[model samples]
Each structure stands twice: as structure tokens, then as C-alpha cells.
Target: MGIEIEVVYALPDEQVVIPVNVEPAATIQDAIRLSGILERFPEIVLEDRMVGIFGRCMALDHPVQAHDRVEIYRPLHASPADARRMRAEARRRRRAGK
Candidate 1:
């Protein structure tokens, strides 16, 4: 069988996953370009973003395997530390019945 892969991109309220079929040993970049994700989302800049396969960081040159899931990550609006602190504070307030 031929190689089957998925390219996924998400926003705060929506997500798109595209299934793509290719010849044996397609690279991640090839899959992303073929998926038409960039055309759909004009805001995505390939040079400004990071992409991964199954949540693991991958290079554009990396060869894809069968059933590989490619993910395009959006830039975070807030820092992880700040987000965690906010969540913790909210939890504390809830526990105090605020």
C-alpha cells in the first residue's frame, strides 16, 4: 500500500486534519505543502512556526512513515509559567468559594 499521512492545524476554536496519500517515503515538508493547509490558513508562516509529528518535534527534511500525523503548532499568546500560575490561582479561589 501507499503511504498515508495526516496534517493537522488548530486555532483556539477550530481544528483541521487533512488526510494525504503519497508515494513511499515522503518528507514532512512535502506532506504539509501538499495538504493545502497554508492556503486554507493564510496566517500560517512556515518560517515562523514549528511543526511536529505526533507531538514530537520533527524537521522538515524528516521522512514520513505510514499513518504519520503531522501537527502545525500555533504560537502561544501567553507563557506556560504564567498560564500555570493563573490556573493555580483560579483553583485556589474556587476552593475558597470565591
Candidate 2:
């Protein structure tokens, strides 16, 4: 028998979710490959990337259960601290103009 799972990837302008069926023993990587998501999005390089199940990060080798939603994560363009700093600066600028 097989398990049904969803593999998802998102970009700023687009998102894709592919439903896949794999053997019960399949791992996250196996489901991803079976879904053909890699082919559709050539920019997804798994070696340096992180993946998750429902919002929790997991290793590529992690075994997937039925109905699992596997997500491919994109690298952050800015660190969390840097992003917060930028937002604070923007807020200060707005207040000064008012």
C-alpha cells in the first residue's frame, strides 16, 4: 500500500502543491521526487535547502506519514535581526515625517 502526501514550494509570485502517492516506507525526499516538484522548479536545490512537515523543520530522510504536507523552504534574504532593524528604521522615518 501507499501513503498520500503533498509536496509544496512557494515563490514570491507563485506557489505549487503537488499531491503524491508513495510506498508506506517512503521518506520526504522520496515523496518530493515522486511528485516531480524538482523538475518543475529547477531552482530548488535540496542539498543546501531545508524542508518541513506542517511548519516543523525535518531532515530530508525523515519518513513521511499519510496526509503529511511537506514544505520546501527558501533561504531568507535577511536575518531576523536585520529585518527587525530595517522595520524599526522605517517606522522611525514615518514618525519623523508626521
Candidate 3:
């Protein structure tokens, strides 16, 4: 028998959820490939994007358990440093009555 798992991906306005059954020994990547999420989300690149389970980043080869929810992460539009800098600038402007 195979284990059932959910694969999820999200966009700014949409979410893609896929349910699949794979061997208990299957890796997270295996379930992802079997779920066909790549076909559904052309923008998703396994090589560049991150994958996780239950909100924790994980390796693609990580083993999957029954009912595990795998997630595909999109690349960040802005780096953390850049975001912090931008926010600081905005705060300064607001304080200065700009």
C-alpha cells in the first residue's frame, strides 16, 4: 500500500493543492513529481525553488510519511536586507512628514 500526501503551492492570488499516493519509502521529490505540480505551475522550477514540509524547509530527498503536506516555495522578490532598508526609509519619511 502507498501513503497519501498533499502537495501545495501558493501564488499571490491563487493556491495549488494536489493529493497523491506514493510508496512509504518515497522521497518528497517523488511525491511532488507524481503530483504533477510542475505541469500545473509552469513558473515553478524545482532547481531554483525551495521545498518544505509542514512549514519547515527540507531537502527534496527527505522521506515522506503518510498525510505529510509538502510545500513548494517561490523565490523571494526582495531580499531581507533590502526589505528592512526599504521599511526603515519609509518609517523615516513618515516621521519627517514627507
Candidate 4:
């Protein structure tokens, strides 16, 4: 049987609640599409993009359970590993009084 679930979108200034009729085995991406988020936020490009569910990184096609919170992640401009390396280098220099 189809189920009704609440899909929430955390926008810049507001929250959008969409009640969706979904099969119990739908992925988070499917839920977002059903929620019309891609239609609402045209800037969200999903190809090769990372996604998270309930604050944990997950595969794009990861299955979403009922009441699951899905969050689409935008690509970072810089690599986090590189940023950390830079910070560590700066700290080393400061310690050496250079």
C-alpha cells in the first residue's frame, strides 16, 4: 500500500512541507523530486553531486525510509583536505616565528 510521508525542505529563509504519496521503498532523490524541490530550486544540479540524509553523507540513490530527512549537498569550491593542509602549514609557520 502507498504511504503518506512528510517531506521537509530547509530553504534559505523558510521551510516547505510537502506531503507525498510514496511507495515505502523510494530513494531520497525520488522523494525530493516528488516534493518539487528541483522544480522550486533550479540551481540544484544533482549530477555527480553529494547528498546527505539526516546530517550523514549518503549515496545519491540511497533508499529513504518514512520520516527521513534528506539534505542535498552542493559541491565545495575547495577540497576539505587541502584546506586542512593549508591551515596546518600556517600554524607550523606561526610556531616557528616565520
Candidate 5:
């Protein structure tokens, strides 16, 4: 018997939930590869994207526990600093227009 867990993928506008059964101590990447999501989304093939278990960011080789919620994260559109700067710029523009 294998350990069964829930895997959730948060797409652009929707969420895909899947049940996965893997051996204990399986890595996040291992689970993702086994779940067949890789074939569906080739964009996630990059290593820069992060993977997590149960909402906590984890390493690709992190061991999975039974009933864990494995999540494959998408790459950020922009860095945090950049995003904040953009937001501030937008606010400045709004204030200037006001």
C-alpha cells in the first residue's frame, strides 16, 4: 500500500485538485511528475518555480507525509521589490490625476 495525499494546483483562474498516492518520503517533485500535471503544463518544467506542502514552501526533495497537500507554485510575474515599486507608482499616478 502507498500513502495517499491531496494535491492542489492553483492555476490562473481556477484550482485543480487531485488525489495522489505515493510511497512515503516521496519528494514534492516526484509527486508532481507522478500526478501527470507536468504533461499538462510544460511551463512548470522550470526549477525556478517553487513547490510546497500544505501551504508552506518546501524544497523539491522535501519528504511528503500521508494526507499532505502538495502544491506546485507558479513563477512570480515580477519580484517583490518590483511589484511594490509598481504599486507605488500606480498610486502616485492616481494621486497626480486626482
Candidate 6:
């Protein structure tokens, strides 16, 4: 039997969510391919990006379940540590100016 799932990808200005159905044994990668998300978003390269289910990171080979929300993650421009450091520095500079 086929399982129902949603595949999503977000951009700064837009988000795309596509509903798909796949075999019960299908993996995240399989659902993504069936969703036609890659064709719609040519910039997405599976090998270079990460996939997940309901916001939790998982391997492309991870088996999918019914009602799963398969998400394709974009590469972070900055690491969490770097982002935090930058924000703190900015806050410090603003405080000093006041």
C-alpha cells in the first residue's frame, strides 16, 4: 500500500509544499523524488543538502511513514556558533553607542 506524505522546501521569500504518495517501504529520498520537488527546484542537489522528517534531520535512506512531512534543508550560511557570536557582537556595539 502507498503512504501519504508531504515534501517541503523553503526559500527566503517562498515555500513549496507538495503532497505525494509512495510505497510503504519507500525512503525519504524516494518520497522526495516522487514529489517532483527536485524538478521544480533545480537548485536542490540531494547529495549536497540534508533531508529530514518533521524538522528532525535524517538520512535520505530513512524509511518514510504515513503523514510524514519530508523536509529538504538548505545549507546554513553560518554555523550556530558563528551566528550567535555575530549577534552578540552586534548587540555589544549597539549598547556601546548608546
Q: Which candidate should be chosen as best, given lDDT against the real structure?
A: 6
TM-score of each: 0.88, 0.94, 0.84, 0.62, 0.79, 0.92
Which candidate do you rate higher for lDDT, 4 or 6? Answer: 6
| Candidate 2 local distance difference test against the native | 0.94
Models ranked on TM-score: 2, 6, 1, 3, 5, 4
Q: Write the per-residue lDDT of candidate 3 for residues 1-98, one digit (tens) a residue.
A: 99999999988999888999999899989989999998977777897889999999999999999999999998888999999999999999999995
C-alpha lDDT score of every prediction, in listed order: 0.90, 0.94, 0.92, 0.74, 0.85, 0.95
What would the per-residue lDDT of candidate 5 be over residues 1-98, giving only the tens digit for each residue? 78998777798899988898998878888888888887777777638787898779998888888988999888789999999999999999999999
Alpha-carbon lDDT of model 3: 0.92
Where is the poorest 10-residue window by lDDT in model 4?
Answer: 3-12
Q: On residues 1-98, what C-alpha lDDT tens digit does candidate 6 reach at each position?
A: 79899999999999999999999999999999999998989999998899899999999999999999999999999999999999999999999999
lDDT tens per residue, model 2, 1-98: 89889999988999899999999999999998899988988888988899999999999999999999999999999999999999999999999999
The clash count for each model shown is 0, 0, 0, 0, 0, 0
Residue lDDT tens for model 1, 1-98: 67899999988899899999966778888899999998999998887888999999888888999999999999988799999999999999999995
Look at candidate 6 and tell me the lDDT of residue 55: 93
lDDT of 1: 0.90
Measured with C-alpha atoms, the lDDT of residue 56 in candidate 3 is 97
TM-score, candidate 1, is 0.88
Single out the weakest 10-residue window by summed lDDT for candidate 1: 21-30
From the highest lDDT down, the ranking of the candidates is: 6, 2, 3, 1, 5, 4
Give me the displacement of residue 12 in model 3, in angstroms.
0.9
